[model samples]
Target: MKKFIMCFVGAMLVLSLAACTPTPVKQSESATEPMVEASTGGASDKVPDPNVEPMEIISVYSSNEDATGLNQAMDAVDELTAQSLVDKLIEYGVLEEGTEVLEFDTKDGIGTLDLSKVPSSGTSGELLMLTAIGNTFTENFELDKLKLLVDGKNYSSGHIEHGDNDYLEYNRDYKKL
Candidate 1:
């Protein structure tokens, strides 16, 4: 009876060990092939692929929240990676909706942004806009300063004053009024 019990225990242990073992899966050669056909067309045909992963969303300062002057009002804008930061700010009502980026260029550590329209607002509003725009550009680009222009002319609002060609230091800090 002892011999039979010992043999039964040994068999049970072997079976348990076997049950816990993992099985290897064999993959076919076709499984490693490309899933989609490569495009052979020109550069214009290279539109954004829907199957590709989407870009990350980001937050920016909003003028509406700047009025309170207690906490920074950072508004989340979606699907704005393709759009310019200024456009996103405008869409968020930080600037006038009619404001358009005519041309933007960065060279020799200096960045220039030419706009077709400029928002007319109070000094505090202008300051908030400038801070938001300056921060956005400096944070993204490698630049020592930024020059903002509207229709090839200098930009001056109630409180802010700068020449059409003057380079303004990139400042991200904002003070509440």
Candidate 2:
């Protein structure tokens, strides 16, 4: 009688535990078919494309001292856009010809530019480069701040100093082209 009671209690406990546990949801194969069809598009309906191209306007700075004004253009923006903009500055004599952006990343609303490949110019030159970069990124990403890393170390723009991990806010008023 004791064995029977213990067995009954154990069974009840197991059943109660099982009842409290959530069951795995089983979806029918047909239910998933609609989602797949929607992604691929159906004969009658048009599905919105997810791979739409990104349109970005870049602010390109000229090297000429007299040309403080920026030139703007609608271009396909990417990580390399930072490098291209810097290269344009160098070509025009705004930045040193060898200056380049090695890598770029935007995470958690903070944009970082790796300038390991770029050599150090003077404070005035660095300030100009920084302004051009800040303006370009802010305009495109709507970001109010950015970080510059030179050779894996935090780079000070000389105009606005930022801590090692701090993001520098865009403070320059760039003239539109």
Candidate 3:
């Protein structure tokens, strides 16, 4: 009798273990295959009749964030403005007696200001060069001010032809102090 009971218990345990095991689904019998595709930025027909236009990207040379209601500050950096500014400075006699700036291309947060033509006998002009430029531009145009960069980076205060000392600096928190 003990032998019979031991055999019955062993069979029951095996059956229970088999029932607990999970069976894998046959791939051939499955109804659908998995599918995945990369998604892009595009509007679906879900929102019909949306008044939207294509996106336009442009480089901003200057903006007039502080000059609200004034559109002059948002002027795009262009050749005309650059040439005018250079001419104005020369006319203003800020370049000393013999200083001659060959080019003034300030765009995309970068500038290539060349002043190698300063006359041999003219007074050295570096201190007021950048300040005069900043003042002249800000005064005439309604812009949100500009930051000067050399070859697309912040310029250091070096000597001429280096585009040094032409950056714009501003303070964000001034009221508390």
Candidate 4:
């Protein structure tokens, strides 16, 4: 009876261990068999309607929840133009409402964004705003640097100011705090 009990316990332990082991999934080897494709995250991989205009996926940057650093979110825009991007930023609340992109032009590797109004946020605010805007535009426009203008004039805030030739470089060095 003692030996029988020990054997029964050992067999139960071995069966439990075998249940924990994972089996490898083998793909169908037959060429004529239809293979199931893995999901590409979500519906983003689905085919678009032929009647609808194609849209572009763009990264829209906004201040994080703490309003300290930037966080990126993907957005779809009808066009990749500067106005469209600015509209997206406004929609995300990174830029203030009523902000308009007066002009956007790229020369060489530097791009200029002229806005109707730039928020007058103080030092840290300006920093976050500029970083979010610069990172977004530089990344989307494939620009090395970006210059900002307000009402066709160089942007100047209470805590931050830009010279006649000042430009913001694509700041990808800092991680989100």
In model 3, what is the error at residue 144, expressed in angstroms? 2.4
Give the runs in model 3 whose Cα sits over 4 Å from its true position.
1-80, 96-125, 150-153, 159-166, 169-177
Evaluated at residue 125, the lDDT of candidate 2 is 54
lDDT of candidates 1 onward, in order: 0.67, 0.63, 0.44, 0.86
| Candidate 1 structure quality by residue, lDDT tens digits, 53-96 | 65645545555453733123444444443145777777767667
Q: Which residue pairs in candidate 2 collide?
A: 63-93, 63-94
Q: Is candidate 1 or candidate 3 better by lDDT?
A: 1
lDDT of 4 by residue, 73-116 (tens): 99899889998898888998878888888999999999999999
TM-score, predicted candidate 4 vs. hidden true structure: 0.72
Per-residue CA lDDT of model 2 for 33-82, tens digit only, reads: 54343354565577557897654446554333445544444444454366
Span of 10 residues, lowest total lDDT, candidate 2:
61-70
Q: Sort the candidates on lDDT, descending order.
A: 4, 1, 2, 3
95-142: candidate 3 lDDT, tens digit per residue = 444444454554554445555343222122343344445544544443
Give model 4's clash tally: 0
Tell me which residue pairs clash in candidate 4.
Answer: none
Stronger candidate by lDDT (2 vs 3): 2
Output the better candidate (2/4) by lDDT: 4
Q: Would you estimate the TM-scores of all the predictions?
A: 0.57, 0.48, 0.29, 0.72
Kindly indicate the candidate among 1 and 2 with the higher TM-score.
1
Positional deviation of residue 56's Cα in model 4 after best superposition, in angstroms:
0.8
